[model samples]
Target chain A: MKRLTRSAQRALDRYLHTLRTCLTGSNAIDAHEVEHDVLGHIEQELSECREPIAWARLQIVLDRLGSPLMWVPEHDLPSWKQLLLRLRIGPEDWRLAYASFALWMLAVVALLAAYEPIALGALLGSFVTARAARAFGGELDQSDRSKRWLTEPALATAALVLGGAVLLSVLPAMALVSRELVEIDTLRLQFPSVYHISQRLVAVFERPVSWGWIRSALLHGGPWLLLPLGAWWLVLGGIARWRPRWFAITFSPGRPNCAARVGRLLMIAGALVIGTGVAIGLVKTLSIAI
Target chain B: MKPRKDLRPEKWTTQLRKGVLELCVLNVIATGRLYGYEIAKRLSALSEPTVREGTVYPILSRLKQEGLLEATIEASSEGPPRKYFALTAHGRRRLRHMNAAWDLLDDNLKTLRRRTAP
Candidate 1:
């Protein structure tokens, strides 16, 4: 290519960028060849022009090039290519929005028809599409009033799926960090008060800790489960408040403050449960022999 | 900012020009190998607004992709290497068939229009 002045270069770069974008979205085969052809043609046209070609000179050549969007005739395109081209170029980048909604709808239909695998597939697709949509979407797209119908179902599903996994993970994490409190003699010799608290803790749970126990407790731990569940919520809530940004994936990016508030609520609930357990354990341990 | 596609009367003609341009490009290369710029120039001279000069590249690329055309890049004294496009054996066969079909279609259309001429 001939040397182009800054303005000429910018214009050419912008044109090529738009062409690249359209081609990428359309899934056009051998797209680089088309790009190379355009560049070669531009170089040829400017070859005769004086050195340091200006935008004024380059603009004329580009004007004759027409739009890259309509370059491939509709009939020439593969069916999928045509669909993607239409969606990508559609108004307001509605591809992500509508595609998510469509997938979610398909999932619902599949579920209705008792096709669990298909339903799960569609739900997974919806979540993926929604995540991708939100990841790429601009602030305006995020705040659009109509986005609820288009994006919320998948986003909500994603939140529920992810939030449940996080909650379930907390119990095992706590178990890993806390072995059987029955082995309190290790702390008994070092910290007398800590051993006292450990004894009270074991009395409160009335059971040993292990993977099987945790699994059973998860299903039927009853009121005893409240302490662990509260702790789980408390930790999550703290993280949500401290770094609301992290919860952006689990909730709408714009609503991190809501996550913070939810965290605060979780912390308060956690405190109440822990306080109740401590009070109950202290009473029970105090009544027993030393 | 776009070049005017066509006036109302030339709308159909502009649409027809897209398909015709493919055959025209094959015919141009059938003569001998020509670089991208020269082919665009020759086609542009024949049809200005009706057939965009810019469209020739995509048609050339499509034909090349479908094995109808092959390109070789050759260094030029002018500057950057020039991509010289030539019809392949398959391309020559496709062009022959296209030309034959066009002749048949063109003769029938001309005869029908003549019979119905107001």
Candidate 2:
């Protein structure tokens, strides 16, 4: 057989990878025998060609064989495998399913670790996964176009709320467990400034504070910020649903409406608030250091 | 008399070709053993809608699994070792039955066509 160029070899590898994916989890045919036969066929074709093998030429041969997914005779597949194919969100949504499952697993791990940052991120990840799944499912379920808009957003919102609730409930237990395992003195020594800040804040409030209390306060307080944002999103969604014309006019290019103007003003106000807060916090820290 | 028309001739021919492809593969290997590439080449050369090399392998694999075909790996001078396939005794018996069925079907269809011809 004529030697394959570097690019041609890569193309062949990709073609084989697709074939492997199609063959995996399939019980109707012996994957090994089919794979070997395919390789042999490619080699024979290359040998017959007078020119050196290139990606364009190899692509022509691969395309003639058709898509690997099409090669599997669905009727020959076992009942379980047939069911799996039918249940799949879309023709290529297996990747999304795997991603969603992985994110859920990570959320569990983050909850166990009592890491609020990672846990929150994981909750958002689940929302994204749910949204992606719904989008793909909608594309596949084209017959139900009217229901797609409602169902997908509802599913995504449910995933977000449920995942967040589970994470929140587990967090307090995780903090309590961590507090009992670790010594307060060691924690103060390890994070002196953080301990000092908690102490000062507790003193101002005239209340007792510990590492666990500080962590709980911070973690719980973080999600309160999301409430307003979520409400805003819902408001926008409601407006879009009830008055699409107004929503479109508000967002229309070059000609902004009252809502758009108000939104822009609010955004600017938010940025100013955050900027001022950060600047104040920076100045205070610097003054204390001096 | 008026001749009957196949409204979807292309679709009908496609289904017919797919149904007979396995039988054609059996007939190709009836004379002697041939590798997947060689079998595909012979079929494409002789038939319309050229049999692709990729399409031929799965059929070979299915046949081998069904006990109708057996294969052995032989080292080649050109590149990798090639798998050569041959029909088994059971395969030959099955082929004989398939051929008889094909002949019967073909004869009956022809007779029907003759009666309907203009």
- Expressed as tens digits, the lDDT of each residue in A231-270 for candidate 2 is 4444554554555556433232112354455445545544
What is the clash count for each candidate, in the order shown?
1, 0
In candidate 1, what are the lDDT values of residues A124-191, reduced to their tens digit? 88888777765544332213546657888987876787778886685555444334544766677878
Query: Could you tell me how far off, in angstroms, the CA of residue A166 lies in candidate 2 after the best superposition?
Result: 37
Candidate 2 chain A: worst-modelled 10 consecutive residues by lDDT? A247-256
Q: Report the C-alpha displacement of residue A196, candidate 1, in angstroms.
A: 65
DockQ for all models, in order? 0.37, 0.42
Off by over 4 Å in 2: A1-7, A25-28, A48-52, A83-290, B1-9
Which sections of candidate 1 miss by over 4 Å? A25-29, A78-290, B1-8
